[model samples]
Target chain A: MKFRMNPVYKKELKISVRTVRMAMIILGYNAVLALIGLLSFYFTFNYSFNNNIDYSGILQIYLILAVIEFGLVLFVVPAFTASAISGEREKQTLEILLTTKLKPSQIIFGKLLSSISSTLLLVFSSLPILAIVFSIGGIRLFDLIQLMLFCVTTAIFVGSIGIFFSTCFKKTVPSTVFTYGSIILLVIGTLAIIAVSYMIGVRNYDNLYSASSTMIEYNPPGVGHAINLLLINPAVSLLALLSKQFGSPSYLSSLLSHYGKTNTVIFDHWYAISILIQMLLAVVLLCISVRTLDPLKNKK
Target chain B: MLEIQGLYKHYGKFTALNGLNLELKKGELFGFVGPNGAGKTTTMKIVSGLLNADAGDVFVDGINIRKDKKKLKEKIGYMPDFFGVYDNLKVVEYMEFYASIYGIEGKPAKKLIYELLELVNLSECAGNYVDGLSRGMKQRLCLARCLIHDPELLILDEPASGLDPRARFEMKEILRNLNHKGKTIIISSHILPELSQMCSTIGIIQKGTMVLKGTVEEIMQQMNVSNPLLIQVVEGQDKVISLLKRNPFVENIAIKGSNYSIGFKGNKVEEANLLHSLIENDIRISSFFRQEGTLESLFIQITKEEEGEKIEV
Candidate 1:
């Protein structure tokens, strides 16, 4: 079959990208990235740095810049995607769209693609500055590629979540708030659960050692499961990637390695696993979003 | 041709369509007249494939909508009552967008878009932003968008709902032209006189069911109400009144100046016999003609009957 782009995606992109608002957003985004890069350079120069050009310092700047860019993407992607369907409904264009021959899945995917593509533009624009880390010898080209992939995957994941909420709610404000609320719950809730479980493990070990009254060492049961839980947390995955890149043991990796030799497949390769989890979440949310959009499928 | 059989739809606890059945033949201008919340829009949505009936089937050109919506959608063009336009798209681009939605693109899509815009009398505003167009112009643009695919059946839901008199007239002219071109149209409107003037057939729905249907003459006959015949006499008004009263077919004779307005319930032969009796009585009649039953009266009569039935139930 001959392939065709979703008409909605084409039209939305044509209208959105041609707007003054999108131009201002791009200008504002690049300015912020440049400011962050300059600030990182100034801080690196003034703080403890070698007399020669320090590659590790540059790597730190790269990581900080990447995090800031990711933060901006997370903030902006939901605002766009969360309003995709609800905005159509509010503007009264959804009924016309529904009467067309386009399938629900095509509509959902088109909305998602347009939302993430804008964020990807921002991510790709910051790549030249990110390439400065390549010359520093610590961060390789493959690391930058992996980081860009992670950024894109994260955008798709978050964009799909916003679309899912957009399909569920009637108004854009509520859908947007719910999308952000879900991200917050995923990030903080996962970390909070891990912290509570760790405390419980430490307390239980203390109790067990006291009852035995012998110098017996204790390792928490199901530490691998706990590490698997952290795999879904993007912050933890970023931390693990940064530590691996700099060849320095950060707190995230130290925590994982502190536990005994359990199968830490996810923890050892946390970056890849985090991306896979994000992809899985994106697929699930997109499926649900398409289903919600299809009235017939919704009933049956 | 389109056929909707035993269509039923429910929104939560309320029933929107209950065993509703309707059919439209080729080249027909089918006017769907109904009051608010009478399931006109619900049925339109189902036929457009934007909604699914709870228990029924919609067939366009003998292809079941449920079995092959993708193929069926190509044969139907739907214009909603309140559709929105894109913010920055030009009128021509707006047409092109919907044309592309129906799988027509590139140069052929461009040519088709221009033809549709010309059909809707929007050729002058083709280059202007869609958002900049007036409400009537925007409505016309939406109509143009609907015809971009050249579908055989056009389903227009309240196409002239918020239009001014001039705009309504223009829209009517456009629809009349489209109907003249042999396209089947299903139009829902509360403006019964407009429908009476244009539609070849009409179906009035009330309480989620078809209360009255068929051609205007057929519905007038089905209503079973007496036709009001007005007779004017140059000099024998009293004689005419006496003669009309004596006639068995005439009732409720009322006087307006030198004219007599009486309720005549009989067919053409009986009306001719009554007229012959009036002439033989030496009543010099200046004029005598029967008023045709209007769609407005028929709609009111049918809905009143529906209300009576509901109260009895």
Candidate 2:
């Protein structure tokens, strides 16, 4: 094989190699949580619902504990990427690397991809725990695929935010703090938007709900519609999915068939719009980083 | 060859360089001397392309730096005033990184890296992390990295700043050897003595401009100091300055107890004639020679009374 001459990427990859050992610790935590998720679902396998232990309560207990695992994934993925650039500036190594013949795009991409590799590892480690949920019944293969898609899109969105903030600040402490703060706000912001929209819709159209009867639509505000929550916020999406499966009494058995149909448009809207917005923002933000890394040209 | 014509740089209202013109041929070491903020560093940065010049052209091997920076960059090596080493990178890797930047690789690259390590005298420390090396070693390694592309011109900014006497000597020797090999070198140094040893000519800058530019001897001629007469006698050598001060041409005289050096007021002939008269008084004048002007003395003489005004480099 012919040896290629590439200094900037070679050095970046070497530096990434040393720091990526720090990645194992991130994956290790996910592994531990996934094992716990597996055991919890296993113990709920043959449980009775004759007394007060209904199927809805059984799934609720497991879902709450499982949401915590996804939360850890979201929190650490940004943290891994937040310091990638600022750390180089702190050590005084970035300038020398910039002097090389390597283009600025190569440098920024190498850093972004390095962090993504670690994020991918943590995302995949949760698979074993998720498989146990399959045995609980009513889980679709399409839903599982949609959940993984949601994890990747959201991580990419958060990872790009982390990379951008890291370059925006000089010191690592301030950069990392703002990145974490932004991640928390992003999560809350999504939930808040849905809640506000639902309240307004209910008040405007009284037909949507009534005093003596229930509307056919079961709209859960602050969460995605059944399909959207499945694809975008898979945890909440899955909760809405499981809610339909185990609820209701013997007297009204036939009402359960129509649960998944309500508010399906929310997924249709967010899926296309979120992917487009996230991708456009990621490309634009990284272009700024390329300019940031240009030593002589960018500063003036 | 490196040629700079009509170079000018401004930071806000402050102009660092104005209409600066210089030419450096291969095998010549040009010393850049200046007081604080004299634009010596600014000019070097422009030539090296670390900082852009507001006006003018820098051509390395006849390729315009502005028009074709990558091509020009291939022929010029720049060592900034301050630099750093990466963590977990060894000396060999550091050299390899730069070598690869120049697009050299495989057996040829490994061979070049080995030779460069030896050239910088860091061969033994090839496996050691760069941060483990001393400041002087790092500076040498930086120079070595600059040479990885076999650049024709070298722009070194304060190459020996903050080094001990021994380390400074080592740096000086390394630079001298590179200059001896027909490399065009532009060196900015605060230590005038270092420049004195190796520089063929110098430009002294004061307050963002080059005030004095010439050979060492030419700058000495501009000084109003009297011609120095070195009186080596068979007998009483110390009495030369004392006896000469009373004469017409002498100013600021220093007596060496038994031997002395007096600043002569006029031309070489005038001082020699004065000494001739002293010999008639049986003072026994055997040998007399004019005191040579060192770069350090000339640097002080030009910049001292200028009152820190901005000058063009």
Task: Point to the candidate with the largest DockQ.
Answer: 1
- lDDT by residue (tens digit), candidate 2, B82-108: 756674788888887777767787789
Off by over 4 Å in 1: A1-3, A43-54, A200-224, A257-262, B220-225, B233-246, B255-259, B307-313
Candidate 1 lDDT over A141-163, as tens digits, reads 88888788878888888899999
DockQ value of candidate 2: 0.35
| Candidate 2 CAPRI assessment class | acceptable
Score each candidate by Cα lDDT: 0.82, 0.67
For each of the candidates, what fraction of the native contacts does it recover?
Answer: 0.66, 0.43
lDDT of 2 at B11: 88
For model 2 the TM-score comes to 0.76
Question: Candidate 2 at A193: error in angstroms?
Answer: 6.7
